[model samples]
Target: MGLNSAMATVPTKEKGSDEIDFVRWFSQLEGNLAETLNGVLLRAARPVQVGAASGAQNLASTSAGRLVGWSLREATGTAPGVVRIWDGRDNGGALLACVNLGQGASETQWMAPGGVSFQHGLYVEIITGAGLSDDVEGAVYLGGAE
Candidate 1:
């Protein structure tokens, strides 16, 4: 069964406490706990390679949520390249983040700091400079309630 299904099996019981409804309190607590746990698990999901390109490429499109983090790796053995994350369909929109990869095989990771969130429902763009012999591979991490 799924996590939500398992969480649904939790029993709610009523308890007398002066003028308070302990059953409702417990139910709400369980729901909050489950949601928190689910968020953590979602953030821990494996990264997926959006795409690889020699020039500018549209890496991925989000589903109306804040991008929390990302991991990028240069798959080709050519010169280093720059990867930029945009907030729109093309690279002409607002720039959200950028990462510089070293020459040859190299990797890097990024995470949004506290009190910062990327725009919702936007597209991430990856761009590389000249001398790219092979395509670049990378993945992005997204979070927030959608």
Candidate 2:
């Protein structure tokens, strides 16, 4: 299941314990604990990294996946290139992020503490600029669900 679907609404505790409903408090705490555990497990899944290539790279084959984080470096080219991340099997889907590399070598890293879920998949690609042999190298951090 997707990260959001797998999660449940945790019960909330009372603002003040005037009445001191012990049973209700306990239930709320238990629910909170389960939610925390689920989040930890989803985020802790092994991460897969995809390298720079001519075309878009499919980081995860699973239909549903999450993007935990990613790190990339761009350099050694006539001009800077852009690193585009998408939530799909290719760049045809929704755009997650687009990092424009500096004229000189530069690096970037993106992370979602709670993780970002995608229904399609995760993809990354380097779009070179003006006869630029830009080498945009990066690794995508994938986790949750698939």
Candidate 3:
């Protein structure tokens, strides 16, 4: 068999390891992905929400830590970016609970569980300026996962 065909071969040891196709595996190599894009677009909020209006911190609750396994997609054409989430609150302080987006690098992501819980608050804010200026365009997508 040719080199390419050799790598394409799959084994029958299905019980030993979780079988993943080479092409599909490469497609979702960034974390146990449920979405596209080769980077992270979601995660547990910063124990709070990062909002607009110049540093309006939305404090997170205890359950905020439960934010994991989140996934993200892309909303191309929306310049600067758009943060869409399900809003919720806890006590006097509120949290973004589930968040989909990168912190610094494009490939960085953090997610929250869906169906079982929500992203605490549905506060959608995008701050792209001097210090943190990365237009939320092209590769910008958000959704619930895990």
Candidate 4:
């Protein structure tokens, strides 16, 4: 038997090319090469306040992008709860993901399997179980090309 090896190759563009040509050339590269080269990375984190009942609230108004990771913290609560993320201003939109929190003061974190992108806005909803306080707070992290 014989073993063979293959090497990756990157396409090159001529100097003095137009911006569009440069972009097109970069777009042909594999993986995140183009995004890294173009500096089109994003990372954002913001705190969220839980409502008194099951309700949706606008966590952050972001441009079109993907949510990479998130976290929730029960700053002042003793009851287990559930946190949900949405793709719109309220719970009336699509649900992106949800994280479950245990009883007592604690924090929960989650990351998208392959990153979740939203075409509209980003919202969050918090639902506490019975006998649990609603004074929960936490932060969310988002990342994308925009």
Candidate 5:
């Protein structure tokens, strides 16, 4: 028997597409005093929300990129603990868009197709109660396969 044949190896597969998985997280800080700190992200195909107490996540396709995971826990607070995402690249700086949730207090939608005329740098700010400050957290994710 030859000793050269005793070595073992694991085969690796290559990605068929030039796709990559990426992710980022932000947190609501301890004492974040928001009645609802929206996590707005700009998508081109409207993402989907998951679970209760949380908001829509993602429904994205790479205009030229992959759909990674999420980037959460960048803040801390009362934590509305919601994440509402959308498409068309205009969810404010908000990790998630509030408009998509639809009618927390309305019979009709606030807008059509895309809500709130999103600008290039419309910052997604928090909406907490008066005279209170706490922390909150959330994340964004990206992923695609070949």
Candidate 6:
């Protein structure tokens, strides 16, 4: 048997021209790529306060984005409650998170490093114990898109 025939061959996919160009462009850029990306991300980050409503409140009505972080606090400082964050308009769509606050002047904060993606928007439903205020005070950090 020939030495060439005795050797094994492996197939590999070739990189496209666009990908090659992108790599070259990225390499030519000044400063750290991570730092550049971080700066862009920081500029896109936005904070919106949740309305003090007893029922559902529309936090953000954007086309596409994500929920980066959120903080909730009891308004009246009387009882415990829960804040259900939705990934759509009004109370519709998937539930992103449920933050529960303790009784008598409580607060809760949560964060998703990668962010919770949302296509429609964001909504929050506040539920409190009986004889307690349904009002809540907090803000949600929105990232991605406008």
TM-score leader: 6
lDDT, candidate 2, 19-39, per-residue tens? 445556666565544323335
* Stretches > 4 Å off in candidate 1: 1-46, 53-59, 112-116, 132-134, 144-146
Tens digits of lDDT, candidate 3, 1-146: 42332134445665554444665555455444543235554443322324432443333222222333223322232333334333444332343333345443223344433322434533333445444433332211234222
Clashes of 5: 73
Backbone clash numbers for all candidates listed? 0, 0, 19, 0, 73, 0
The residue ranges of model 6 lying beyond 4 angstroms of the native Cα positions read 1-44, 53-57, 105-112, 128-132, 144-146
> Candidate 1, residues 36-142: lDDT per residue as tens digits?
34455332323445547344335455433456666666666667767777776667667887777766555655455332254544465556446642455667665
Model 3 scores a TM of: 0.24
Candidate 4 lDDT over 1-146, as tens digits, reads: 53243333445476544333444445544334312424543223333344442453445544445666665656455567677788877777788887776665556564554477776777777775575545556566555333
Candidate 4 to truth, TM: 0.55
The alpha-carbon deviation from the true structure for residue 134 of candidate 3, after best TM-score superposition, in angstroms, is 4.9
The Cα local distance difference test for each model comes to 0.54, 0.61, 0.36, 0.57, 0.30, 0.64
Worst 10 residues of 3 by lDDT: 137-146
- Window of ten residues with lowest summed lDDT in model 1: 2-11
lDDT (Cα, tens digit) per residue for candidate 6, span 1-146: 42322223344465332223444445445323322245563435566777573442455644557678877777766677678888877677888888877764555454555687888878877765675557777778776432
TM-scores for the candidates: 0.55, 0.56, 0.24, 0.55, 0.24, 0.59
Angstrom error at residue 38, model 1 = 13
Cα deviation of 60 in candidate 1 (Å)?
Answer: 2.5
User: How many pairs of residues in model 2 come into backbone collision?
Assistant: 0
Instruction: Arrange candidates, best lDDT first.
Output: 6, 2, 4, 1, 3, 5
| Model 4, C-alpha of 27: deviation from truth (Å) | 13
| Candidate 5, 1-146: lDDT as tens digits | 52322333344476443432221111222112211125333333222222221563233322323223333332333333333444344443334354211112111122323333322222222233443222223333322111
Q: Model 6: which ten-residue window has the lowest total lDDT?
A: 1-10
